[model samples]
Target: MLHEIGHNLNLDHANSEKGKEYGDLSGAMGHLYASETHPMMCFNAANTFDDLEWYIDRQKIIYKSSYFWEGDLVGVAEYDLCRTGKYVAIKIPKGTYSSRGRYDYYISFNRKILFNSGTMEGGDQVLVHKRYTKSPSKSYLMKKLRSGESYSFQSMTVHVQSISTNTSPGIATVRVTKETPAPVKPVTKHPTSNPTPVPTPGLTPGSTPDPTLNRTLGPTLVPTLGLTLETMLEPTLRPTLGPMERLVEHPMKKPLECSPQQLLKPSVTLQGPLSGKIKHSKSSKAKRPLQHPAYPWNKHSKTSKTKSSLNHPVNFGLENPVWHPVKCNDMLERSCINNPLFFLKVKGRRRNCAWLGRKKWRANRYCKKSNKSRKMVCRECCNSCRICTECSKICSNIKY
Candidate 1:
């Protein structure tokens, strides 16, 4: 069922050099067996996620040919398996130019635990797979490396410095090195003959010539007309009217709608200069409720007997100031969500509020005053229910 799901996700079988089909044992797409007791199998290969457009979601470190040109020995990069905070895999393009590269290599650290327990063979090793750029579903397993092992191809070498497979989520440090690329020769274009300069138009006789127009116009290039000070000095198309002659103006032309009295006294509907005087009557002012300074920020009001926590605002410092009552909805849209790969269980098989914000009933149990991680991750969710709400107090001594 798992292997077929990979097929549904546009992932082909993981192939190997022995000519036997489904030979790669590191991924579930390869030859595998499932029993009733151990129904869950291994996760799909990193290449499968790449094909599904989860490149950023899976956190893949892509190294191009230009990376080698930047410096020698492009340092040992660490990859944490199934962790959102760190990279899960590394990808390298086949050719010098990444855009034109026909093939791409993906390296990932695989382990035997949870879903990956089905494949017992070569479970604790870094697996490398090559995929054709044009056909993403076609993936070929190239090599498997243990600690200190290295793989070489097309003048580029990937060396595994160290790997820890015993941990919950394994960590692998790998370094990429390449041969110094040959310096490219600069191309120079020369004209057959000297080009003539085009004279700028609409310029005064004594005015300085336009700097751009002074440049030599090439035979193949077209010159644009230039407008200078001479264009502005031309006579006006229409004459202006005098204050005394304004009485004999055209009847079709509309007069100003705003009177001088309306400008001086603004109305209640418009408290600005455009309308008349805006003043609240005694009866209307008496009906308006008076709010205490502390009651707006704090949920527990001393004067009111009502249990509603609607007016309470969450303060996130001067930068964000206050999260308004209506706009306090979760700012973490699917696009900006930095959710973890696996739903890590806390306590007794329960997930944290940060991971379960969308599922309100399941998240309510974890949204406690003691859960400090909840405030940092799901602030909007916590603020909505007036649970464990507090103002952000940044230290003046510290620079963030």
Candidate 2:
């Protein structure tokens, strides 16, 4: 019986702080290790590279995905491929672009990483060549697969939409990322370095064992690693299960059961098109929650009177610091801008870690303090940014 090793190997979930998730790779697991694409010691996925052979012939990856809201169909892990990682090219289905070749396609290696993060980098991946746009896998690009390394297409996800084998096209138009099969005869002999010597019960002296089972999937390709050429090219369908899905007792607070009223009579409730989009905002001073466009700061201090002098702030009566009016999309606070935790700004939403205000130069600390870090939740938008409860604590305790 062929045994799977890595799945039970105990690597921590992507956002976790400690345990096997942070273990070194060399002999940690098996498969193989050649390059240091990034260091795993740091919190950022950019700092993670879980590449070690860890004693295995091969294994397939499956992800269970879901769509959080409408128009967010990332259910298929192939979606991640459209962004890093080695992949066989796929045709852009008819619909996405009005003009052919005008758009681009790629498989993202680290979706949560800011490929284009640093100042030097307007962002990562922004400048990289569109690896997946071209159709029919080319031989030159075949080197990546031939190297015996299986690059990841997506990590597990909790908030965004994901595709499933059962997903309908009404929500999204996703094609499966399929593998191309190798032309050579498949190898069965389990050639490995850690020769614990599984007693091949029926092997001839010089005869090799057959290649690992196909475990073929149906349509969408699951991002694979350390796979054989046959595994790479075979048109494997993804598990109807989203390759990377997490189930939570989604807060009952979500209005999943309550939607806007339409069938009710006018007497049931008075309804009219609300003139504007109401939102939530916080005051610089300690104050209770208030409506958006707060009468105090949103009335357009003199600077908001007209588009002229767009950068200047209009004077207001309250002595509150004249917060420079920033476009809703840009709201990194002064503390965030200056804090060593600047990674919070550089990294976008849903990422596991944020650069909290660290005190010293390059030194950093565990963002969570006591024991409750894993269950933390953070929102992505500026108006609804989520931060760890411990962030406030660690930010204050660490030396820097």
Q: Which candidate should be chosen as best, given TM-score against the real structure?
A: 1
> What is the C-alpha lDDT profile of model 1 across 1-400, one tens digit per residue?
6677777777777777454578776666776456435344554354444766553565454455255421111101222224454455567766643455676777766655555555644566777777776654557778888888887766667777887755545666776667533547977697567665765686577977587856786675555468646777886676332212221111124332322222111213422221222332233323222221112212232433433343444332222322334211211111111222213222234233332332222333222224433232322221111222122211111110
Q: Candidate 2, residue 308: CA error in Å?
A: 12
**Error of model 1, residue 126, in angstroms:** 0.6
Worst 10 residues of 1 by lDDT: 69-78
lDDT of each: 0.45, 0.25
| CA RMSD of each candidate after superposition | 31.2, 40.9
Cα TM-score per model: 0.38, 0.16
Worst 10 residues of 2 by lDDT: 138-147
| Global fold similarity of model 2 (TM-score) | 0.16
lDDT of 2 by residue, 1-400 (tens): 0002333442222211122232322111211225543322111111111222221111112222321111222112233333222221222221232233332322212121222121111111111111222231110111111112232222211111232233321122222332323337889788767866687587566877678767766865766569878878999785442211221122322222211121111222112212232232332232322212112223423324332222434221112222233332222222221122232222133222232322222213223244443233322211222333454321222211
Off by over 4 Å in 1: 32-39, 43-46, 61-85, 96-101, 180-400
Clashing pairs in 1: 265-276, 266-275, 266-276, 266-277, 267-275, 267-276
lDDT of 1: 0.45
